[model samples]
Target: MTQPKVTLVVSPRERFSYTRASLESIYANTDYPFDLVFVDVCSPESVQTYLKATSQSFKILRTDHYLSPNQARNVGLRYVLDHTDSQYVVFIENDVVVKRGWLTRLVNCAAETNASVVGPLTCIGNPAHQVIHNAGGQCYIKTDFKNGQARRRIKQSAYLTGRAVADVRDQLHRTPCDYVEFHCMLVRTDTFAMTGLLDEGMLATREHIDFCFMVAQTGGEIYNEREAVVTTDTLGLASNKAGLMARFGQLKLPDFQWSDLPYFMLRWSDRWDRASLDHLRQKWNLAEDKYFTKRYAGLGSRRHELLIQPIVQYLTFGKGSPWLEKLLISLERPFNNYWFNRYAQRFEQS
Candidate 1:
């Protein structure tokens, strides 16, 4: 059988310093041959010049549109669809430095499982003490801030209590996940032909999550290749987040009630004003299970604990909750994490 052609796509957000490092890592670590394409939306001239001059093997497409990361990705992918006869397209962020065998593993997994999307386990933060970063955890809406401060929460993992990245890497096995961050995901080109590209309107957040749902809805299973580890400083997070918030005239701070986070919740939960959850729920036939169902598990009070505060905040926007109640919430988190991690293991297996 003929090997399928592959195109590696990279669209750097802000700094090119990381882009150079990331590109070098890809060329060094990737075991298979691939056509490389870099899409830049207002990246530094030095980075562009370097890429254009350095590699005759790859092509750099630079546009001044300054589009959102998702839009920029679609733009890059549009080029891939038009120019390359690639059977597979992989998107790796400019900020990530990949590990050896990362690309091979993703490609093999996709071929083996016939997975629509397969991504490596991303390690973010300090290399020594990394977190699962963007390797899909329990997908849910985050609420419960206290006096303009964020609260600790638990996500689904094997240990069921993935407090850190090690928790994810500790038990290495392939598992079906709700979503895989696009930072380093391999997708069959036909998947796009079916579900289309990233939703350009999402701008900054939830685009990948939305894409996962789209793929899954289209009979595509998204999986994590636990053996393929990508050591990225960012756990698949969008760069220039500060600039994004600034553009919206919103400042992100520890101001207890993050005015910025709700932008993400808009796609989920009727509790939030700008929600499209009903439409999404209908689109995917989503319900209490396989969505936020895992996130609802915790130390105590699953549905009640999950919805009560969100309901209050929705009814009152951030003014309704009392400080004493906030204190109680803070005190309750340890136990909550304990229960969430313990119960969430079921979701990981599902």
Candidate 2:
């Protein structure tokens, strides 16, 4: 009997040491035959030497161009689809490790649920932890008040995060979600061929969100398998951010370019204006600032006379304290009223 085939893609350009362990963990734990694909983008000589010296059997696509995750993914996916007969593609970031049976659960869930995409419960270490790092999530716009600021600023986010609460993680099987982030994802071979690849114009930011939105537009469901687990080193951006900054400085990396705001608005916004940003912030129960910019700096305001008239409702309406108050007003928008759907008509699926 032939074992089922899986193709895994990983890009390692930033951290060399961590990626070595990441590769070892996969080779050590995975139980199935997988065609491992690595896109080498301007990796240092030492890193390249290490990869070449490895005993592991894998294929490497070499390039000098700086391909964002979004672009590199396309290069590898096209290669897999065109050169191999694998029926599944798994995309995992470099700083993560998978344990025994992790791949099994992801494959099993995708098979049983017939989902277009199946992702696992991501924890915070190689041994894994209770705190859920990433799961089934949705795109949301938010506003918040801060010290030394005049007016609230608008931001976009995924609705659920933080230490995985018991209720959210208490599940026997896969669950449906608006979309699943790409930290670790197992997708059907046809998902890309059918729906097309991530938008190159958007670069690395919010491409997963946009991809999920695109999946929804095609009437496909994304599932999160609770049992399948992987471990990550960073929590999106906030948790291990200080360490990340130190790495950037240590590596003497150049400035980083982020394009979540205008790119997302241009892709999904109904108006792509301040009103749309503010309305989306109120519509979605998002909190915190993932990607702040000069344009989103707001009316130069802060938390003062909040109860006073003209206060930003966002002050009390987010994933923070004052649960009852936030919950009551949060229901103003119906649950099924996904803002992405409004743009489904104009958004390009293919």
Q: Pick by TM-score: which candidate is best?
A: 2
Model 1 per-residue lDDT at 337: 51
lDDT of candidate 2 vs native?
A: 0.59
Tens-digit lDDT track for model 2 on 13-108? 234345567788899998867889987664556657877887368888878644556677778888889998887899887667886888988888
Cα-based lDDT for every prediction:
0.61, 0.59
The pairs that clash in candidate 1 are 131-165, 132-165, 148-255, 148-256, 148-257, 149-256, 160-341
RMSD (Cα, Å) for all candidates, in order, is 14.0, 13.7
Candidate 2 backbone collisions, by pair: 149-301, 149-302, 150-300, 150-301, 150-302, 151-300, 151-301
Q: Write one digit per residue (lDDT tens) for candidate 1, span 1-350.
A: 77788998887543345666678878888888899888876555666678777768787777753445676688779999998899899988777777778777888888888898887877664442255555555453334466886543323333222346555446667767767887678889999989887876554434676787678778888888877877554412322211122325443321112321221122122222112323344444444334343333332232223333543444444455665446556655554455444434643665
User: Residue 15's C-alpha lDDT in candidate 2?
Assistant: 41
